[model samples]
Target: MNKPTLLFTAALLTAPALLALTACQPSGPVTNAPETNANSVTTLPISELPLHAEQATRLDNNLWLGVHPHGDIQIRDGQGALVGQQPVAAEFISQRRDAQGDFFLSLTTDNQLMFYRASAQGISDLHLSAELPWPLEGMCLYQPSAQELNLFVMDESAIAHQLLLTRTQGELLAREIRQFPLPPLAEYCVVDDSTDQLFVSEENIGVWSYNARAESEVLRKPVDLVKPWGALEHNTGPLAISQGQLLVAELGSDLLHAYPLDGGDTRTWQLAPIAAGQPLAADALTVSADSDKTVMAVLDDNNGKVYRAELTLPARAGDNQRIVQVAPVAETRPMRKSGDAADDPAIWVNQQQPELSRIIGTNKKYGLYVYDLAGNELQELVVGRVNNVDVRQGFSLKGQAADIAAASQRDRKAIALFSIDPLNGQVSTAGEVVTTLDNVYGLCMYRNITDNRFFVFINDQDGRFEQYEITDSSAGWRGKKVREFAVKSQPEGCAADDRQQRLFIGEEDVAVWTLSADAGAPTDMTQVAAVSDVLVADIEGMDIYRSDTEAYLVVSSQGNDSYVLYQAEAPYEYVGRFRVGINAEKGIDGASETDGLTVTSQALGADYPAGMLVVQDGRNLLPDENQNFKTISWDSIRAVVIAP
Candidate 1:
């Protein structure tokens, strides 16, 4: 977050109606629902079948119990009145959902871990996903998404290893299994699901956070998220997360403890204290905090008794823990190159299916990479010497509307073209063409929606800029000379406002300038951001983000390691500036000396449901590892600079 550091004469720009997205809420696996199917395959209604509560979970307005022995599940209202139930073999039953918001059940059998497509009627499509690689003496499944799950499965050898399980079905059933080492004493586990974070309670050690998305070696086990929670060597029971608070059953003592999700100061209460044999053995715990009703249920395993009580977290939560709770969530992985710089990122929004959208980024020394919102690389294009990359859609070529991406190839002194598959979201080479400018350095493309034309701007080391109007020819794509101009100094970052047909260029050593997008039009070499003023020298990346009534031009002020924002309209006015700081919890460093960056206002997925800002980290140090891109949620940006 940042404030305007400079004063200007311009009046306050018009405010925009920042329409909140109503389509999204706390409605994932973390939220509440009235009734849910708890079966992998069709059998019979759980209510009609005779079954007992093996494990109880709180859903929307009711409590769901895993009716085992026959593997059925039942739902009961707040007053302990039976409402609905379903019969299916769901032992370790947990409610999950696919990208479409369709409910599913994360199930575990004697020898298999699986999921079942569920509906109000019943459950079907039993995906017997993964077989027991090693005998799971103990296991915990945290389903944050259909494909993203953190699993702690321990073998009889007393060695615990966390596995990230993934499953996708279509043309073929694709399954992936990656293992992460965990503490040997790790026992019970609980998931926030909203974030891919898990809380594991060690029998001897304190509770720890298990994040498989750590920014280390691809499949390496992540270190502690915040810090090891609770007193060391304390025996703790199960865990339940509700309203940013973690409820714990203290097995070592006759008490229940609650702590802020960040493992800050905690509060405890006695539960069956000083009883006869075992003073209230709390071996299992479940709390319904995602719904209107607040209740907690715990199992006294040694006493063979289950108790339900009202649950309320202390109102005294420290501001520090609150800050950690609101910090953005991210997933960082290694780039293709172990020592290369992570430069530039482009966000592609798949309207039909948001989950399929890809984040295209350049692995400077390796090639271009395509990744999902989870930061998992889906594809990599080994094009050589690629510097800056830009993408556009709805370009009709060969009688078909195509999505084209272009990158500046420094090795060949040319611009390389690639086509993207809309369905599968893959990148393939279209053609290669040389640039008109010599020693091409910076590159960006603009597509005019009104005229259905593509214009690419390329600049060189000598301050010469070339704007080319691209069109598909009978043989291949060709560029026609539009207009050539020279700035006062060398330039790099460049972007165009397609709706306004205005081109803004960044002269690295001078400042930002704007001109007309039309060829042969009058040039406006006006300095929008001067060096040493609102902006610093060596501006590296520039991109435009638009809301309903406002647009912002963001430029990387590499000198200060921050980004300056401005109103994208004519007579461009300054907005504010912000620097992406380090995230020690996820083991990620912020952007510094950013080469290129991209932003999208389109809600990509849960991670970026309100949109996101991705920047290139030129100096990814701290732990001394290869550079990697860092993604920040637009909500975090809007809270400071963009919000009214």
Candidate 2:
């Protein structure tokens, strides 16, 4: 309940300092200043096409496909000669082509999206390969790799959706991964794949740019604006990225503006006149870039005429952020409650049959959930409002050897305990021990390899932490406060390396710290990692993955929906970052906005021979159900991100 206040305080206290530094940087405004070689472009008139197409996309240097207003497509050569036609039977409001020359068109009526293959043979080869449902005003495609295709779409209400499409088993699977707000009256959008940036035009406002990656933050930077705001003469129109520049068309000015992707002076070009000194009212535009030359096509919507011109493009280096993508193998059934109810997850390995291990997760709003390895809900313990949970094995409970799981119960401000039956994999509540903290938040358990003693560490929302040693008694399980400490800010996640006697604690907006796990040891701490580009702010859950040879530390970079890894030893060398993507074949959506994750290196089965990773999915999509947890095999991640 106090989470909102903590977040607000962090932002309020940090905004001034952040803004002060931003103010000192030069304002790289989008200006009307032309490039050094302003008048070196040649303009020529192409033929007037016979078809009154609303929009057109150039397939190559010589082929163009025009979308007609009457629900048909006309294929024409560069000379305006019609080659073939196809009746699409749907009124498409927007169209875009990917790097592979495939076309994606969207219709507003049924909220339908259609896909077609591009072919140089003729329109006969333009067969519908796939279709999905989405409501949008305009859309553009971004291809990060040959196996991944991203679609950025804008709706009439000015909402943008980033959909990830993956090809699997001869089918294209789509998942809506992220959504954010946009200015009203926005119509056109384009993505610069090289930079992973999206540019949108807010009809009467201006052109703005946004980070296009699904894992990036939702922020808008001004590219250009209308008259008084920037250098553009009219409202923004069509948008395209070609030859290291963002080409923006002015709605009614018959002028084209080019802004370098890397901040530079803007260049303006006047389209060839349609008649004797009459400017063409450009509406739609497209550009084709190749090694030989760059071709530009502009459509005069008023007269239904298409004009073509050629220009030279300046050379610039490409800058791209590389993010590794891995798919989830399975996902648990969604929780009964909705809206951020799922917060943390823990894995309980079954000694009898490793394949039968269970994944324990906290509903936070309801209770604890137990799931089988196949992601089926095995049991639901309706304990009230448990925020975080962890498990430790070989604990003596009620005169029997059992696995113990501990969670911070916010409703009672206490530690909730459960005993897992190792043989049958059954979890039963043991007891709850009350704490003095105002609000109990994060919890983790540790077992001493030296003395075989079990203890649990719990932190309050105000940064106070307490360590308790679990003791078995005639009454039941109880905890004695052994040691206490505090961080400068709120800390939610703490993982103990029992073997190294080291404990890792995450201070939400600051950094990850380490200290001795020994009760009598000094409270001195060392900085493991700080919040940076790799480890985004609001660092949430973290756990250690121990292989036979080494141990790797995985921390959730919650701000950007990515996970960062480090060597979990002295020096703590940084590994790589990766994101869980949609598994097209299994129909399981990716995990994002994660709050807690747990990893184990015990070989579970054939699917998880190297170990498994289970994470809480804050935003579960694929049918838009309640939140759930996803499972990813560590072997798959090692194959892509870990070097041999």
lDDT values for all models? 0.61, 0.77
Residue 552, candidate 1: Cα error in Å is 0.2
> What TM-score against the true fold does each predicted structure earn?
0.50, 0.84
Model 1 over residues 205-283: C-alpha lDDT tens digits? Answer: 4445544232212211211111122131235667777666666666544455565654454555656432444455666
Number of the top lDDT candidate: 2
- Among these predictions, the greatest TM-score belongs to 2
Expressed as tens digits, the lDDT of each residue in 514-626 for candidate 2 is: 89988888889889999997898889999989877979889998887888888899788888888887775576777777899999999999889999999888767675678
Local error of candidate 1 at 562, Å?
Answer: 0.9
Clashes of each: 3, 0
Clashing pairs in 2: none
The residue-level lDDT of candidate 2 at 241 comes to 80
